[model samples]
Target chain A: MLKKYGIRKGFIAALFLNNSIDFISIFFALIEIGATPIPVNMAFRAIELDEIFSNADPHAVITEKDHLKVIMKYLSGRIVVERNGGNFLMRDSGAGGFGRGPAEVDHSIATINYTYRGYGYPLGAMVPHIQYLFGSELLQEAVRLDAGERLLVVLPMPHIFTLIGCIFLPLIYGITPVISRSRNPLRLFETVHAYQIQNILAVPELYELLYKFRDSAGDCTPLNAFLSGGSVMPDEMYGRLVDEFDVDLIHGYGLTEFTPVSRNIRGDIRPGTIGMVCDGLEYKIDPCDEFGFGEILIRTENMTKAYYRRSAESRDVFQNGWFRTGDIGRVEDGHLIFKREKKKTRKVKGNMVDLLEVQRILMEYPKMRNAIIECNDSILSAAVEIDSARNFDSEVLSIKKFLEDRIAGYKIPKIFSRI
Target chain B: MKDNKITTVDADNLRESIIKTLAVIARINEKEINDSILIKDELGIDSIMSLEIIANIEKRYNIQINEEDTMNITTVGEFIDYVIHIINKK
Candidate 1:
């Protein structure tokens, strides 16, 4: 079906789990035949969907029957894979068949992921061919994944980081990946126990839930390692996991732009550091004097070619052959330690304050379990969740008093809420 | 008696009903429960537990409690009264 539509050239494919497993199967089969697959996130709303499709301009879009009306309105000259029945149509394109052998082409742009909330950049990031190859190779070398390893992937497939690290990397090494459609905590644990999953790749939020389940279960089954990304892993939670489960918690730093950059390979892992850069990737810190933290610039063979259609916007960040990650980090003794990004910083009384620092400080209080520091241009506010049945007001007041002495009065949070 | 008046059920009866309802819903031990117990605090019942309790109580008693009635229930006594009021209605 793919070859008949001249989709032999690398193309983007849209897949929603409900109606498009057949399309996905065929898409993976195409990948085996050297056709690049662009997997779109099903979570995208109409406005966000239009922006991505307009920018990417994929050669073909494979969608389910339910999403056909909305997708067909925006896309033209494409192939539609219907999921309701076993009917496939190559719309506006001719010539179809399979197996023409692998085409030797430069792995320029393999896939494009759209960012959430349209915050950082319009098109999230592009994964080039070389980067995927190098990243998969680097992860394979670092993790020592065997063909018999059972990997539990808890994150959504559309997320670029999970796509490469958990899904593609495992496929590359011939490891079996157990993909669960449900995120229900009990069901997730059932899947783990049922499959005897040894390796897990998940976000910090899912890790927290799993930790609670493990505590309740009493008897602990050792997982090889828990790989976390997508958000900052709280230090206290990291410590608890190590103490209780005796499992090494590995952290990787990557975004939609650079799929998988750095990973804590050996179990001798640092809690807060993102570890060394992946092989075949070059990184440097942008100049900053205050905290020795700067924008992380990465130059790699796998860096995205360009923003699909936003040439002018792409040029702003992609300068002099290096892609500006907008993430702030400090290189400590050769390892890249990621701090909060500059955009997350706030200015008070002409003094700059890092929100992550405030969060870390609040997390130190015994009563507080989780904290998020949110700041607008003028005022900074904090939301904290405490252990069940604990009074958070006293803790919040104490934190405020402590900050008053250490930081400027203006830097202290103006409002605090128990969430 | 008024149509919506809850019958003055004794503590033993309330305790038996509550325990049976909770056990049926969550497969938890009902014998350990008491009238003075806080459903969440004493039982280590989280929000999911509360949701299951609400569903089971409605099905067993053939009664429906509004969101407002459930929100006001902080203690097991109040939860009993809330369920009785809904059951008495029908």
Candidate 2:
């Protein structure tokens, strides 16, 4: 079918798919065929979709039946392939042929993964196939997972952590990767017991859910370890998981540009640090302050070289063959101790929400004089300096309505206050 | 003697009230909401907002909602039915 549709080498396809077997198969198949698969977040609304589609410039869009209508709005004569169960339905809108991508991107790139680091907009990280192997190799050594063990996966499929840690790592190491369709803690517990799953790689949010539903989580004894990333884990939550559940709650720090940069070793775990830097990467803290903390710089052969179509950001991030990870941290006794993030972003529900971007979107409303967005313990609130004459209540509602379509649901502030 | 169970009219009122509450929380019009629309997916409601909705329903009805009952709920209709069931049980 790919050959029939002229999906040859260098073909870029946008994947608007759910977390299902089809997503995994299609992803690997695209890579196998030498095509670049852009895994788009399912939570994205049409507005976000439009921006990504415009930037990605995909030749074809592969989506399931549920997302076909939403994807069709931005198809613009590109090829559309709807996967229903085991069958494939391919059609061409014929408005035009395959859309041209930016000529600057390397044609041999493995995948284009979209990421946002408080950049107001997302940039596609052009990850090579070698990074997957390198990242998985590092994780395998750090976690010490045997080939026969089962690894539970419940995170969003489009996320880079899921792609490398959950999907590729398991495949490469011969471990059975159990994919959970829902984040419902009860259902996940059942999956763990059913598969006798040993380890899990999830964000802190999932671990929180497990803790919340611990009383109901029937027999999670088979679980050996819980690897956390994507966001910082609260020290209290980490303590509870370790003390209550008796699981190795390993915390790692990495970005979409490069993954498994540093991780806590399985047996020799540290409570308040991101553990030692992974092998094959050279890292340093630039211009340490009084506390011996600075912006972390990593030089790795397996890191992303460019953000697709974003030349200015690409140049800004990659300096002198070292990728400036916008994370503030210090090394104490060979462990990478995280201090704070240098970027203007907050992790809401384990997803990065750029505060400046939210403020910018809030300022788009005509009535607002200024907007200040803040996060306290992962709860986002927006205080707007609106015209005093306008009804405060109605304007608050209007701001909520304005933000609903512009950004993701999680990015929308929970509380609105007058500044 | 009086019946403890909520009548059909009472259920209708409760349903309407819940839908309106969800609409207000999701920042959408009541007319935009349908029984079949997904609470999280279509309405752009996240887990935090869902908790708010659950809290509102719990306070209004004077009942406690368990995590398991709300966790597997996919659609708005399911949520409405579950709440109505809880109210009836009360």
Candidate 3:
């Protein structure tokens, strides 16, 4: 089938699915054609959309009516397929329909992914064919996803972490993926219960929300495993899920540059650690202090060839044929402990303050579920979730006093909130 | 326009203005506002608090703030300074 579609060479194809049939058909079509299919995130904002479009520059884009205007703006001169009375490509099963030809292609640049990093860069990173193939193999091994396993692709498809880790990885093993149209917590829970989903790949945000919803609903259906990423999953929340839901959650760590770099798939789940490195990936820790934790430099078969259009930035970051994942982390007892991103760290009153550390501390409180710490020129502020029963004044005072003694005075949060 | 004119106060008044604004926001939202009140901790402001505070300061001072100016605002004092900077820029 790939030989007929002229996709023997590397080509980029996008498809919009109205139902499970469309999604499955496209999956088979792409694999048959040897073309790498890039899934556009439906939840992406305008800036994110612009980045994905500009960076990917896919040969063809298939989208629905709701996304026509945005997709058209990005794929102005490229071939566009409209689906289901929408400005998207239709799923063609016959010969010469969508992908039905072979061509010589560059094996280096096959798949492109946009990590939702606000508005800075459109395409966060690109994955070459070899890397994508290698990533699929490694992830399948790490997560123990086999042909018989039924997987749930609940995270946004546009993200490389989910696309490769969950969708493509499962597909490679011949496991069918249950794709959900919406990400609403209630709907996601219903989908899980209805589909009897054994494996799930989602962000920590989604997991936390689902955990809360499941707690209130009182219907606890057993799930084989849950995979979380995108942001740090607090140990407190992890404990809550284990204690309440009796579900073992695996934490996956990777960026757009390298998908599924490290993961905790087996037992001895450390709350904060991202787990051991995956196969075919080599990692080195350049610790700033004696503890051997400074910068995380990685080289893998799955690393991107380059960042599109940002050659200078790419050159600066990609050193000695290794991608320097701006994040600072340490390896302890065979587990990767993420400290903070180098760019986000601030020097407050002569003390190096990791804002992520502050955030983790704020979120540690039982009353606070999620917290974001933002620092400006002279002051630091924290946004925290409030327990309904706690008094705001007392909570704030305790938090302030706690930080004042533990951290530097400058690191103390001047502004506090439950918002 | 004349009636809408707000008096330009000193740095002390600017600081007080920010505190008052925060207090008013807490009262309106039925949240407890105190010196150490975590803006997102007591209420559920999220990222919108940054926008709301910026908007309130703009309305109160009749000044415009750019993205660069907004970067300095984290605490109440810095937020007041941010407003003053915008006021001076205007």
Candidate 4:
């Protein structure tokens, strides 16, 4: 099957797919054949998609037929492989072969997952196969989920949390990963009950909805543990999940650069803290303040050395064999207690929204002079300085309309004001 | 010109337009959207998508839908009706 598509060693393929068996199968197949697969965010619109293609420049794109209309223009001369049964429909734009395949082809790097640095464009984190192989085992030791247990995977698979915690970990640990298509709360409950899922690793936002829907529906489905990560789990929310739902909510922390940096121990659980750093990983708090809080730095064997195609930014984060997490925290009783992000980032619905990234895109507005985006009370709003000749009302609408096309709907600033 | 008042004819037209708009945003066939169809459960509209839908409607109609109004809407029919009401009030 891979032969027919001309997918060979060192071939770079972009997977623009949802959470399904096909996504996993394609990913594994690419890895098996020594190819690098980049899992694209399903929510990405044309502009986001274009930015990724421009950077990664994958030889081919594997996506469903529904997304064809949106990505057709970006295809250019690349191959488009549709996940349609036995007969794979491959579209070639007649611009010679696939593409100028990866020049050097560093075999150590497994997958290049795109992530934000709280500013500028997103950088692709080049993780190796060894990381998932080893990190999953470390995570398994912490979470302690047995093989054959059904693990509900409701989050988007492209993100590091879901990719590692849900997909890779399950695959490596021999656990059953049941991927849910929708983030709808009722549907999530339905999937949990229907599959008899014993475990779930999700973001805080889903847990919040599950609590709401579970309470309203009066569901009593049994589960082993609710593993929370991707974003900081509120102390109150953590308490509610454990006390109200009567379930153990295991909270952990990590980044796309490195998976499972730290995870709470199974028996020795803490409500707010991210718990001990994962075994085999080294962590240190640099520049400790008077209150004992500082930027958490992690050095792991499995961590990515540099961001792919981003030398300067990668150099900035990676220092002396340690990855600057950009997360402020302090060690309390040997547990890594997260304080707050030292970077210009905010979590909206558990997804990191880069304020600088938004501001950078806002500056692209032809009418705009300057823009500042900030999140207050969990609501993202932007204050802009535009030309005085332009009507404020029309410019706000135009800027929003411009942003809606570039970024995800959730990342869009809700309120706009002229400065 | 923006219409501040929606008459009976205007309301009907507006409702149809909203249904069409939502169908496109939700990526569902227009025929599939009905009164009983659950917005979140059936259409798979999350908080983000819901906000996007409201933003699109507000942009088109030049009207604002508050957070409270958004909370009150659950079904496709209710959302269409609420938008129509808001348009009428506008």
Chain B TM-score, candidates in order: 0.69, 0.91, 0.57, 0.83
Candidate 2 backbone collisions, by pair: none
Instruction: Let me know the DockQ for model 2.
Output: 0.12
Best by lDDT: 2
CAPRI tier of model 4: incorrect
Which candidate leads the pack in DockQ?
A: 2
Candidate maximizing TM-score: 2
- Predicted structure 4: clash tally: 0
Each model's lDDT comes to 0.63, 0.81, 0.61, 0.78
Model 3 misplaced stretches (Cα beyond 4 Å): A1-38, A45-57, A85-105, A116-119, A216-221, A344-419, B1-90
Candidate 3 C-alpha lDDT tens digits along A132-213: 6777776666667657777778655556666676566876788778887655555566677888777777776567666655
Residue B74 error for model 3, in Å?
Answer: 28
Poorly placed runs, candidate 2 (over 4 Å)? A99-104, A388-390, B1-45, B48-80, B85-90
The residue-level lDDT of candidate 2 at A322 comes to 93
TM-score for candidate 4, residues paired by index: 0.82
- Find the 10 residues in a row with the least total lDDT in model 3 chain A: A86-95
Q: How would you class the docking of model 3?
A: incorrect
Residue-level lDDT tens digits of model 4 in A311-404: 8989999998999988999988878899788888777777777788788888988967888898885568899998767777656656766886
Predictions ranked by TM-score, top down?
2, 4, 1, 3
Query: How many angstroms is residue A91 displaced in model 1 relative to the true structure, after the best TM-score fit?
Result: 8.8
Q: Which rank order by lDDT, best down to worst? A: 2, 4, 1, 3
Instruction: Let me know the TM-score candidate 3 reaches against the reference structure.
Output: 0.61
